[model samples]
Target: MEARLPYDDYPVVFLPPYESPPAWVPPHERLYHPDYNNELTQFLPRTVVLKKPPGAQLGFNIRGGKASQLGIFISKVIPDSDAHRAGLQEGDQVLSVNDVDFQDIEHSKAVEILKTAREITMRVRYFPYNYQRQKERTVH
Candidate 1:
């Protein structure tokens, strides 16, 4: 029987049978911390830099901000888009965009920052399992 660790929608095997860790993981893709007590439990912040082609969209949806008090989160990502190719994912918290701090920015302001930039460098962190709980904690 395959022992599996549960996730909200993505169950994974505890480990691959007798396989050693990868010889290397890309810096942006490394799992730097695994402690439950860490505010970010399972993922590391990835800096993704994307430059939108002329007249083309960045192709991602965002949610949350200071007004909403939910924090900035990536609500959707379009497949094959630059954002997707850069490794942005749904539920990723946008810590910064174009190096502008997003943690306390208003919704309208956040929208403006994303819309105005031709090139964006963002630090994003994804925490799928405890997303709602984390948001709640941040709110309180």
Candidate 2:
């Protein structure tokens, strides 16, 4: 037999212990408080940025075929790191490092590029799957 459980509609927002949302208000409509926003930093997972000098090389890894099952593969950048400062985001596909094509290079060679280059020029493909849905329109 299929069992049913009760569902309580709770607000996703952070609330103080002494404060409670109004009964008539739905959780989704709650406003974000600046203090609550600051507190959220403590709960969510975060990445560390690797530090780099004025001009430093960047790197990434890719597995599977050139198409499917491809992930960022490697995360060498740290939070607040130099690469992050240069506008490098996580999950970015590293197409080229130092203007060198990475289509068929060995893994070790990729690492060497990051270690030696004074400045990194990576041609990255940001989001492959989700962005492909740009042409579709949906109802909220």
Candidate 3:
């Protein structure tokens, strides 16, 4: 009687272990699928300057303290509106308007600042939805 083994006639080859690129490699230089490179998390907060003609709506809502506690926040952005076209997003914390600090400001006062300006320069911090939800869930 002879002992039998599976695939006794097949040739086998071994390959060296694969190594990933070093962390120091720049993202653009790394070998990655083109479709995988669009990372939304890498986006940084940016200031946007919008020039609205008189009577033109900014197309966003400003809320104070209710959801953001001390910070004035962009509550809503109307689709296809000037604010939307200008890159304003919901949940962004308004840092300043023109040159004035908006921290802890009243909602009406913030609106006043916006309404009085023909050209608005807004500095905002982008608040990701997940981060905001996590913040709201935390008890403090």
Instruction: Tell me the alpha-carbon RMSD of every candidate.
Output: 13.5, 14.5, 15.6
Q: TM-score for candidate 3, please give it.
A: 0.59
- Candidate number with the higher TM-score (1 or 2): 1
Tens digits of per-residue lDDT, candidate 2, 42-137, equal: 333233334435455443333322233232223334566556565555444556665676554555666676666655666655543422232122
Tens digits of per-residue lDDT for model 3 on 1-140?
99666796767887756778534646675567444455665346579898889988888886664344556777789998879988888778788999898876666788888998999999887766533653454332
Clashing pairs in 3: none
Note the Cα lDDT for every prediction shown: 0.76, 0.46, 0.74
Give the candidate order by descending lDDT: 1, 3, 2
**Winner by lDDT between candidate 2 and candidate 1:** 1
Model 3 ranges with Cα > 4 A deviation? 1-43, 66-68, 129-140
Tell me the TM-score of each prediction against the true structure. Answer: 0.62, 0.41, 0.59
Order of models, best TM-score first: 1, 3, 2
| lDDT at 106, model 1 | 85
lDDT of 1 by residue, 1-140 (tens): 99875666695557425756546555555555332232444488889998976678888987777855557888789999889888988888889988789888887888888888888999988866444544544432
Number of the top TM-score candidate: 1
TM-score of 1: 0.62
